[model samples]
Target: MGKAQKNKTVGRAEMSGVERLGLRVSAMINSPRAQDRCAALIHRMEADQDADWEEVMSRIAETDGVSMVFQDDGGVLLEWEAPTDEDRVLELGEVEALEVEEAPF
Candidate 1:
C-alpha cells in the first residue's frame, strides 16, 4: 500500500496521558477565574519545599472551580475536580498561555 493509504488503514487511538493533561491545563487558562486559581496554586506549590509537582497540580484542580489530571511518581494517573468553597475568590494575574511542550518524560 502507498504511505497515505497505509496511514488511513490505521485506526484512531486515544489521547496519551500527557495530551489529556495538556487539554485540562488549556481549559483552565482559557477561563479567567480558573487561570488565576492555577497561578495561585503554582505560587503555593513553589513556596512549599516538600511538594511534588504532580501533587500540587492535583490540588490546584481541587480548588473550588477547576478540573485536571495528574500523573504521580508511581506512573499512575489521578483525576481531581474542584470542591465548593465560600472563601474569597483568588484573583488571577496576567497569564500568558504556554507553548505546548513535549510529552512528560
Candidate 2:
C-alpha cells in the first residue's frame, strides 16, 4: 500500500495475545458507517481526556476480524471486517424512507 505511507507502523503488538497478525482488511473506507466510525475514533482521541488507549485496542481486537494501523503523525487507522449478516442487513432489495414527524416547539 504505497510502502505503507513511509511512516506508518503496522500494529503488530497492539494486542499481546490477539491474533491479528496477517488479517486481510480492506483498505477502502468509503462507506458512510465506516467513515463515521473512524471519525469517532479520531474525535475520541481528541476529546476524551481520560480515554484508555489500550482498552480501546483490546476492545477492537476482541472483534471477529480487526487490525490497527498507526501513523507516525499520531493518526490511528482501524481495519475491521465488513459487517456481518447479524450486524447489518445489506440486501436492500426494497427500501422505503419513512416520513419524519416535526417536533412541537
Candidate with best lDDT: 2
Candidate 1 lDDT, tens digit per residue, 11-83? Answer: 6678655455545545545566754444311122232334344554565556564444333532222233443
Rate residue 13 of model 2 by lDDT.
37
User: What is the C-alpha lDDT profile of model 2 across 24-77, one tens digit per residue?
Assistant: 122234557775564222222343223354554556668666666776765457
TM-scores for the candidates: 0.26, 0.35
**Which 10 consecutive positions of candidate 2 have the poorest summed lDDT?**
17-26
Candidate 2 local Cα displacement, residue 11, angstroms: 41
- The local distance difference test score of model 2 is 0.48
Best by TM-score: 2
- Candidate 2's displacement at residue 74, Å, is 2.2
